[model samples]
Target chain A: MSLPHAILTALLEKPSSGLELTRRFDRSIGYFWSATHQQIYRELGKLEQAGHIRALPAPTPARGQKKEYEVLPAGRAELTEWVARSEDPKPLRSALLLRMRAAAVVGAPGMREELRRHLDLHRRQLEEYRAIEVRDFPPARRESEPDRLRHLVLRGGIDLERFWVEWLTQALGELER
Target chain B: MSLPHAILTALLEKPSSGLELTRRFDRSIGYFWSATHQQIYRELGKLEQAGHIRALPAPTPARGQKKEYEVLPAGRAELTEWVARSEDPKPLRSALLLRMRAAAVVGAPGMREELRRHLDLHRRQLEEYRAIEVRDFPPARRESEPDRLRHLVLRGGIDLERFWVEWLTQALGELER
Candidate 1:
């Protein structure tokens, strides 16, 4: 459900073909939200059926060809309504935490390695986010509304990666002790 | 599923009936992992069927009668295996982030208020986590292996709440300008 809205927002930002959306998702939206190509294609079909989006005119509309989509007025209205609605924060569901709980019962053999892998992954993600910050926002630049909102979301990812990297290091240190 | 493993770990800590498990989930386990009562009941049944756990014999064998369960050795082994298994970190998927993305397209009318609500919720959650830390893990005390692991998981919850609280405060300040 949110995927459609996410797609709608992405399309609103700039109309793109299915392939283009997938590429954008891989780079930007994929940071916060993720979906497989199959999932994206499926949602696009549903959105088009629901009249929230439609394929822009193309000369050769055939299989494997580009199919650009733009959010309809109805989609914009829906997104605005969703933006104003209050939603509860989802419960934190970390598989790592569950593993930690299980590790308590089963003895933490090989747990340190898993933590290390997570630490490395987070470190890489942090680097990617920082690179984006440097490239997109840069220093000493006036930010537009869209830029500010985008940066706010980016800030969350950066902070989250920081939390994981820091926590994992401490956890590894705890293991050593 | 991780929920079943989480259940096995909790039951390893203390034998509990379905109702007790639900309460525990609501309080502690629910912090990092959550489940509906129906989901709990279903998992309990499956775990019992799979020989990971069994009901403690009770005098009254009536419907709705409390049927306490305890983890078997098989369950412990399964949990240990799960702890050692390497899982890719779950992608970050905050509906608030999604809404924030959507807001960029449609003006942010009620975003500040939503952020305030989230701020309060995270603050309360942090208080609860800290209270647990005080009650369960007082200072200058040697923690058992299990206690340490549990505390590490709790530490994650505390830090995450702190992140949200700080980030939301900063985000609100950004909105003012």
Candidate 2:
């Protein structure tokens, strides 16, 4: 459900071919709402068929060739409505947390290493996010409304990674004790 | 995949009827990894067929009647192996964050209220988790290994809720400005 809207959002930001969309997803939008390249391509077709988007005029629109897409009025209206729509926060579903609980019953001796591994991963992610912040959002620069909102989203990612790094460290300590 | 293992963990903690398992999931396990009663029941049947679990002796044992289940040795072995397995953490996929990013493009006028609503929800959830912490993990109590691991899981839930609360409040502030 959100994937279509995610695609619509990315398209509204800028017209892009499917390949460009996939690449952007891997870099930016996917940080929060991930979609595989296949899913993105599939959704692009559905959006086009639904008249929410259209392929830009190209020299040759042949099969298997890249086709650029831009959001139509319908797509923009739908996305705007979705922004105001009420949706409940989905329940947390972490397989790692579930595994930790399962280990409680089974007494997993190997989970210590697993927790360590997760710690390393979160640390790396947090570092990458911090780097982006320093590069893109240095202080003393006036930001537009969109820039402010986008920076806030990046902050969310940084904070979430920090949470995991701290929690996993605590979990590993619990295991050691 | 994790649902079956979650069922096995619950059964190993205490043999229970399908009805009872569903209730427990709603109360505790569902907080982290939620499943509908229908899915729980379906998995119960599959686990039984797979010989990972078995029904306990009951007087009636009729169809549609309650059937108690306990994990078998094979199930325990499987769960133990699963606990030792390494799995990467799944990427975050949050609709609210996506909505925020979308709103940045479309200029959602109504998103201010939406952020407020989420802030309230996260606040309530955080309070609920804190209440559970007070009731279950008293400071003076000496916890066993299993209890420690279980407490860690609960802490994960609490910290996550807190993260949302903080982030949503910040988002609202940004919108206000």
Number of the top-ranking candidate, with lDDT as the measure = 2
Cα error, residue A70 of model 2, in Å, equals 0.7
Candidate 2: docking tier: high
Residue B46 lDDT, candidate 1, scale 0-100: 99
| Candidate 2: regions farther than 4 A off | A140-142
Instruction: State model 2's lDDT.
Output: 0.91
User: Per-candidate RMSD vs. true structure?
Assistant: 1.4, 1.2
- List candidate 1 stretches off by more than 4 Å: A140-142
Tens digit of lDDT per residue, candidate 1, span B1-177? 689988998899899999899999999888889988888999999999999999999998999898999998898888988989999998888888888878877888899999999999999999999998999887544368777877888898899999999989988887778
Return the TM-score for chain B, candidate 2.
0.96
